[model samples]
Target: MPVYDQERAGGHPGRPLIQNQTVRIVVIYAIFGLAWIYGSDHIIDLLIDDKGMLLQIAVAKGFVFILCTATLLYILINRLLGQLAAADRGRLENLENLSQKNAQLRLFFESAPASLAMFDRDMRYMEVSRRWLSMYGLGERDIIGLSHYEVFPEIPEYWKECHRRGLAGETLREEAEEFRRADGSLQYVRWEIRPWYQAAGEVGGIVIFTEDITERKRFETALEANERFLRLLTDHLPGLVGYWNGDLTCGFANRPYRDWFGKNNDEIIGSTMRALLGEELFLQNEPHVRAVLAGEPQHFQRTLVKRDGETAYVWSHYIPDLVEGSVHGFYVLVSDVTELKRAETERQRLEHQLQQAQKMESVGRLAGGIAHDFNNLLTVIMGLAQLGMRELGAGHPTLVRLEGIQHAAEKSAALTSQLLGFARKQTIAPRALNLNGAVEEMLKMLKRLVGEDIDLAWNPGRDLWKVCMDPSQLDQILANLCVNARDAITDIGKITIETGNVSFDAEYCNAHFDFVPGEYVLLAVSDDGCGMDRETMAQIFEPFFSTKEIGRGTGLGLATVYGIVKQNNGFINTYSELGEGTTFKIYLPRHTEEGARPLPEAAPAPCHGGSETILLVEDEASILNVAVSLLTLQGYQVLPAAKPGDALELAQQHRDRIDLVITDVVMPDMNGRELVRRLLPFCPKVKCLYMSGYTANVIAHHGVLDQGVNFISKPFTMNDLAAKVRAVLDAKGEAVD
Candidate 1:
């Protein structure tokens, strides 16, 4: 360390520090020679003897000094060489460190994501990143150590000025800039320019960072366009549309939302649901709002009383706006469905009516079948009892008992008749009659049925039109209606029977189900009794359907009336409400054509024996036996046939004329019509008399008797049978009416 400063700073002169270094070396050599010559000679003399040996000693002394001087110079040179070697090592280490730091900086600039380039003070490229080369489309060329202006000659002078300013230690940057490439394509760029410094703290070069942002800009433009289109679409929609935040604050509203809430978008936006919809509506919607916010979508219907005082039906949907599996907000859609709701209700009502009609029709059919079977049994009972009474005479002890049996059978026959009426299969002997006369004829009977306290008033319309309905059916309608009215009353109430004329058009019938278009005679029965509700009225005419306790009613009164009206090609309608009175109006088609009038009231004619040959056909053996006995007792010679084929055989075999043919309408082998048709050839002038437990005759369709046919209902007494047979045989003019 001590020789280092001297060797380097001219303190020692081995390396020849100045131009006079050789003179210095020579002077040092002269001093060293004098010292060596003088010191060594004295020492040698002191250590040796004799003037004669002086020349030898002097030669040895000179050699010894030379050797010592050479040795001393070698030591100084070695020390200097050691110090120089240390200095050289330090310089090499510093250079290696600088070189290493420079390589690392070049590497950092090469692979950086940013399009970066490093330049020297003269604006020449020192280093460039791969990204910079790629962005500029210059990856293939080696542009290092080249001037920036030469590499990009197409760049604007303004950019060059920016580079110059950066090299002058100024920092410059651009957030966005438009540039055209060499291919005449436009591109957006973001860049930064700044200077780098050297170890001397002076600006070494300008570094530039560039980014290609064309794709990002394009994406932003598309997003803005989509937002505008969404707004336009939502505004044109029919439903009320809007978006709500998690806190129920309105974020957006479409055009219809303004009409729905009676508020514009400016007023509605940012408003809470409760504040906008009011307390009542908000409470109704609160549950759905919370659900949607909890990420559950909601759909429901509501009837709202709007601000205009009119009501509206709305179907609404609330969809959750889920982002990353969490509910951020919700979307709302509400549509008016007022008309649709009304139509749905009407459709349901019509469907119910159709189902009710189908049910009634089925009940009618069932009741008809039951009535037919029961009437056959009743015929045998009543016929046998009457036969017994005639044989025993009135004075016999068993005569009263036989009469009682006959009366009971008659009552059962009446009940079966009611069933047949409800089924619309009653044996109706229709007569063209005025409604006033029919109501008047039954008024006294109705009064007796209702009792004295319940006044049965007859309000007959003046000069009412005639209706071609059976008189018995009219009697039933009035009797059943008055009885029902009497039962309904807890206290004194009035039962009114009104007769009037009514006409229905096609339009009216269309509106009212089961009504047909025609002019009709209206026979209405009204009562001031406890009225029925709509539900009870709906089932009032169904067989076995009654409101009264089990025994109070047989439940067939109104059903019978319904069947009677329908069978006569008419319709019935009733109106009633709870706490109000009930009114039943029956419309019978007006009888414009010629029709038979009901026979006048007369005494029963004395029974007389018939001499006419008769054909009696019956399916039931007992009824057939009874009918044959009855006819035989009346002195008519009868040919009995169980089947229709037997009746044909009997007619064909017997050559004598069959004055009359009494055949049951429904038979096993064939119906009475076919039997009569085939038998007509054998007995060409035979008088036909049809009998049936069924009200509707096989010879007549739907209870309209065929022309030139005589008909009688079954369950007849001996007297009734004798009277009908004699009448048919004696008809000499036209066929029995």
Candidate 2:
């Protein structure tokens, strides 16, 4: 039977011979027979009074003894059978009590929360809890009555040894066990085995208690993986990162932090913040650290100096780690923002430059518009005065006055030219020229302009590149820059003019932001004088903006230089420091073609009389009258008209051959080009010369004369008109000058 069997009832196994009811009854009857035989012989001897009745007495005695013995046997058998029946009833009650206790024990084992099972000494499954079966993913039928090895054939030898030790009355417990199930999945289990004892205190079987902790183990693994990934991410970041405990000691730091401080993790992990950051920085950041420790997040920007002696701008963030409403530690995050700050500053500077350029552009347009109209009025005044001087001659008293009037008008016209220069509207005559020779030629004039106290130095470049620009404009640029230098000097100062070749590549252009990538001729003018500050430099290009005191300057000098440079597709850069000096660098595009020879100065041809009829058109009354009168005095028959329609009528009525047609460029009735187009039908071969104060956009592109167009700028003398008219007539094809 099993050691812990529930079938054993309350009883002892050993028995005594005297306790047998049948044996005891047989002994009693034997004793009684012996005693009765003896007693009957004695009674017969004592009663011998009647010797004759002796045989009858003996037979009576035998009958009486038989009866007595039979009765005794009957009574003893009945009493013994009654006692045996009572004992059987008591044994039945005890068996029923044992059965109830067995049922209760089975219920307790099956209802346990933990997985439990019992195996006999033979290792066969004796009992299993519902939880044990469910935990092993098995039914009751699968494990009950089966041997431990048969049920879990893949169990490790170690576990089999544990079972053996348990059966030997030793208890075994394992906090963690890796059990590889039959389906190839691993299960984490915590289990214990102990020997179950019988009522006699002997070892019976082993009982196992197990708890599945697989989910908890999986959670731990995932948490570790996530921690490793986060560490990797923070280590590679460009910004410094660290964690600090409440005691102000660093608990962790990423790669950037280690590199910046020139320390490894071993040296830094437990170091105090004050030691790592130094005394100064630690004190500077103490308040923010305190705020974080008080459970408030802190953020600020500061400059951190590295171990290499370089400084970095950082945006620092400290986020407190809170646990159960108490401060634990803080996390540090830093971002390098040095480059971003620099870019923002550069953007603001460029925006300011753009605003200044736009302001100059608006002023230029306004000044150009006014100068154009001013030139027209000066043209009429100069023409009438010059025509009067020709008619009066040198002998007349009015001749001197008329010459003076013409001189004043000519000066006024020069002033208008300066205005147009500032406006970037002056007519340009571009041609290839060598810069070195040009600078050499201007040195004498520049010396005179700067005065004797100031010295002028000309450093001409060798084998300089030729540039396609107007020589007159080049002279203007040099003159303005020199004059500005002269004014800036308070005492003896030196002005240097230099010429050289420079090449700009894409990378340089990108850095400068406003330069074109090409080869250029550099013209730099430097002055050892009172230099300008940044505020003055920014406004220097604006029209009429001057640093000189009132009445000493017109303020158009540098403005004109800026306009001319831009008009010629060049750029200018200026560098200056207060009390140091100033230098202006001008870069003009280099022309690939060979330069042309400088034109020789031409003398004016003498005005002579012509007999051919002339048709002259002018919009201004005074200009038209003076032109007609001057041509008539020169022995040509003149036809004057103020409007294009009147000129057309005059052309039709004139039967004689018209030798020339001089017309004003801009008129209400029609432009000079259109007038010529219509009148050519009447005078097919007549030479035409178009004259204007300034050529408008309709007849010229950006103040440059159109190709094959015969044009002369206004405010001309009588000699100029005569020469231009004759030149137009002399040309075999279309005339440009």
Candidate 3:
């Protein structure tokens, strides 16, 4: 303010034109006033000297006129001088105001926090404020009159173009630009430039304002790098990933998504979901997308077709991408789960099959147990009937009725035995025998069973290894096959039986479930008859399941065969097709032992009795009565009781009298063995005869009879019962006490 005031009070000191104008105005005003005053004094003296009477009057008028004129001139001159002095003061005040405003603007520009500069139309710096100078590490003297390129030599070409545009009257605003400092370090700057205009609206220079945003720039660069890294991480993920905009258009997608969708990135990006997946899929997914848009994450499953024309099951999770507490889009992740779904379905099917198998097995075990018990009762009835028929003469009418009753009971007993075999509870007596020899011996019986209408052929292997199996079961298997073959053939057909050795390998075992790798004796029976379909073969082993008409056949034959083979640790395979005939192959485990000689066939003999005191204990009253009568008729003194306690009392009363104890294995109060233990102390010399319908191992603990003890299975005839009792009582009995 002080310097500006001094300059303004004296007018601008360096401008001579302003000073000269003031001096010329002051001189002209003073000269005009002084000349007017002197001229009026001269004119008044002339007018006063010429004093003739008329002339004096005229002179007086003239003098008066001159004096008035002089007075008017002097007044006008004073006014002019005063006006000049006021004008000078006004000029000086105007200068002082302009200087003050200019000084304030200079102070503002120099002290501004941001960098500020004024560049001429040529892009040369006309003025640079202190902040601008400091930003560039330069003094005012170094920057002024310098071109922008000189101040920042490392400025990009684009920045130079921006400066040029600004100089050409266009405003330039750029977010960032790189400039080089004097120390060769790069500086990132954000700046704006506009053309500075004078009062006449002509472009003067550019006013440029800039901010150093180096740290902000670095932060932005780091953020971009991190985004790239995250994208890379998701690209290699196991599932597809994508981002959708608010309009459900794909904004971004990872590599997996592009590959899975079979679309180029360019084709998918910015495309609406409906365009990519079709309207059906898009509409179906609308609810899930809406949930995500509403700021809820959702999981869903879908079946989609891949690019390769294969269908795939996909599990997807959609999460909202939120900004400022509002959902912007969705983040979608999808995984293919087709195989998992298939596995789950397969597992459920297998579980159902297992449950069915378990139920069947349980029922079979129960049926087998009941059949074994029923057999015992039948044995006693049949033995008593046969004994009654024998005691009566052949001409007696009662003998014919008794024979019929025995025949019916024998048929019923045979049916129960088949049931026991199917349930795998029937006892088997296995002996090592050549399968070829066994088949050869059965050919004659098999031909007779199949009938003369059907042709039977045998293909026996000479060097076949021996197999251990129950002979009766083997015969039953052969008989069943022969019957089945006969039924299949409507007209004449050949049934071929082939026996050989078979060795299964690892590959063969893998293909079949529950099959072991081992040597086996193979018995194959082939029939050129009306074979079976897959459905029939699947359930061929099930009891009572048959394709034949009612009463035409009992379905237990094949079932019995299956049970026997399974119990003997063997496998049976059936190969047949409708109208193509059938083949049944049986695989029996190979035996290393030598084959045994065949047993001699025995002739039927009559029941024989002994003079032994037999204590017979049975729970059923009729069975007890009949058993006592039968044994007494066979010449033994039979002591009978319906209760275990009575039997014990009888044993105590006749401890020395009873020579043998024949008791039922399953009793109400005490079992046969328990009764035997109690009776043994009282009758120390007694030989025991145990009877039961249950299989040998199940009732006698693996057919083990105590000292001086023997066993008789139930459903026996009169001869079997009589013979067993006699054999036990006649032996040298061991001391039971």
TM-score of each: 0.39, 0.38, 0.35
Q: Which candidate is the best by TM-score?
A: 1
| Better structure of 1 and 2 per lDDT | 2
Clashing pairs in 1: none
Best-first order by TM-score: 1, 2, 3
Candidate 3 residue 48 Cα shift, in angstroms, is 84
Decide which is better by lDDT, 1 or 3.
Answer: 1
Residue-wise lDDT of candidate 2 within 1-737, one digit each (tens)? 12233234333311222268778888999998888988878878887767668878878889998999999988987787677666656546655765676677677677766688888888999878788888887875667788888877878888888988998999899888898866789999889998988767788788888988899889988999998898999998988899999999999999988988889989999999999999999999999999999999999998877777877788999999999999999999999887887778879977986787698788778868877887888889888988888887879999888888888988877677777888779867799889898888888988988999987877678889899998888988999999998998888877878777666655345545578867778888877677788889988986677888899888788888998899989999886656546778898988866565643432334766567777899978977876786677677788888899999989888734787888886577667778888887788778878876542222353223464677654444455566666667777974223
Clashing pairs in 3: 379-715, 379-716
Off by over 4 Å in 2: 1-240, 250-288, 299-316, 334-359, 377-419, 431-434, 448-455, 461-468, 480-496, 500-562, 570-737
Across residues 1-737, which tens digit of lDDT does each residue of candidate 1 receive? 00112233344332343334446546777899988888878887898787768888888877887797788667655655665566566546645765676666667777666788878888888778888888888967999899888987777889888988998889998877898987889999889998888656888787889988888878977998998899889989988899999888999999889778888878999999899999988999999998999888999998999888988899999999999999989999998888789889879977986787688788778877877888888889889999999999879999999999989988887877887887778766777788887677777777888999886666677778888877878888888988898888777867777776665555345545687766678777776667798779888986677898889998889978887887888888785645445778888888865666753433334868778889899988977887888799899999999888788889988845678889886565766777777887788778878886433221242233474567765445566688889988887864323
Model 3 TM-score relative to the real fold: 0.35
Error of 2 at 209 (Å): 34
Candidate 2: residue pairs that collide: none
| Local distance difference test, each candidate | 0.78, 0.79, 0.77
Candidate 1, poorest ten consecutive residues by summed lDDT: 1-10
lDDT of 3: 0.77
